[model samples]
Target chain A: MSKVKIESEKCKGCYLCIEVCPKKCLEVSKEFNKKGYHPVEFVNDKECTGCGFCYQICPEVCIEVYK
Target chain B: MNKILSRPESLTLIQHSYCPGCGHGIIHRIIAECIDELGVREKTIGIAPVGCAVFAYDYFNFDVTEAAHGRPPAVATGIKRVLPDRVVFTYQGDGDLAAIGTNETVHAANRSENITVIFVNNAVYGMTGGQMAPTTIEKQKTATTPFGRDIKRDGYPLKVCELLAATGGAVYLERVAVNNIKNIMKTRKAIKKAFQNQIDNKGFSLVEVLSQCPVNWGMTPKESVKWMDDVFVKHFPLGVYKDI
Candidate 1:
């Protein structure tokens, strides 16, 4: 199984990852970071195919994929 | 446990100094990733340009040197000649490479200096506010050109890849963008290729990335990416303009 970790502090909430994820496994979190942008969350992790689209699209390089 | 992806070892733990959604962060990571993959950290020397990426030294974990505004190529040439075995590259913005440093860049390419140049073209000068740059497109509104760029007065947005390709000494020249998932991946491949060219002793490889500037463009991060795709990419078409 692949695990997706979002580094909230480094995330600028660009939502590029969420838009590119084919599985729709990511969503904007309700919480806010110090930068006031809503960090994305990994939802339904089991559905992740680990295609790494989110990791590739993230401008801030805030996502890490672990298996 | 297997790690599919993580921060590239060539990058430091320091948070980037760029504003939110800036392309500099993305480009920095791509360069760092290339360095890590090539296992050239020890011998890699990155020359930071004078514009927005001036702080590139702080981010890249490997050896970094600051060069005068638009003078990275000249500096990089000196370093590469002195330390021929080292993998040398320069990170420069449009204003630095295309504007003030044009002469240096042209001559370096003509000489076929064994160095990689990562040219980030956001059309506007990011560090000093959104001013008109040599790469700024026609009729594009900027701080200096409020009403939009006048072609007759300001001249056309420079096609750097095309210009450099004319220099027979340049072995590789590509224009890539980071506006989407596919393009981002292509951009990474391009970066890696440019670096590999240096390791192979190829001369004068330059990758012009059509990056976005959200804060200076006065748009949100998402909007900026879209603008880069729709407007910016039109002026600077993506692909390898030359390969030898």
Candidate 2:
């Protein structure tokens, strides 16, 4: 199984990854990051196919995928 | 198992200062990735423009120097001439490149300067409160053109790649967008080639990236992307305009 690690504070709440993701493993968080934006948070990794679609579309470069 | 995707080595840990969903961060990451892959992080010298990416030095871990508005091509030409073995590239926005630095860019391309130019064309002046830029599309609304750009008054957008293709010195010229996954992949390839051309002593390569400015464009991040894919690409078709 692959895993994704994200630096939540670095996210700018763009959601480019969440929109591009096929696995639906990412979702918007109610809590705000240090930047005061509701950055996307990673859900359970069980469904992560590691297609790398989210990582590629991420403008923040905050997501790191380990396969 | 190893890490499949992470931050590029050439990029610093400092978070991007661009607006949320801004395309500058994506372009920066890809440029850093290309530099890392080329193994020229130490030898690479970047000339930053006076646009939203002015703080590019803080984000890129490599040696980067700031240039006056639209003067990166001139500065880069001088640097590349002095350090022939070093890889030099300039990151300029449309306002800086096509408007303020038009003469500088044209002359550099005419001279076939051995440097790469990364031109980000979002069709609006992003840094200075979303004013109209030289590349602003016809009938596009901007701060200066609240009602929308009037072709009779403002004229049409400048076609940079096509204009540069007529120059004898430009060895390569390509235009790509970064609105979606497919376009982003093509953009990465085009950017990497622009850098590779410099490393190979190929002269005057420019990759025009059609990026999005959600805040300035008055659209959500997703809407901005949709605008880029649907409308922006129609005006500036993405493809290699020249290759030698």
Return the top candidate by DockQ: 2
Pairs clashing within candidate 1: none
Q: Which candidate ranks first by TM-score, i.e. highest? A: 2
lDDT digits (tens) for residues B1-244 of candidate 1? 5789888899898888788778888888888898888999999999999888898898889899999888999999999999999999999999999999999999999999999999999999999999999998999899999999999999888999999989979999999998787888899999999999989898999999998898888898889898988888888899999999
Per-residue lDDT tens digits of candidate 2, residues B1-244?
7899999999999888899999998899899999999899999999999989999999999999999999999999899989999999999999999999999999999999999999999999998999999888888889999999898998889999999999999999999988899998999999999988888887899999999999999999999999987888999988999988
Alpha-carbon runs more than 4 Å astray in model 1: none
Q: Candidate 2: where is the Cα deviation over 4 Å?
A: none
Candidate 1, chain A: TM-score against the reference: 0.93
Docking class of 1: medium
Going through the candidates in order, what is the number of backbone clashes in each?
0, 0
User: How much TM-score does chain B earn in each model?
Assistant: 0.98, 0.99
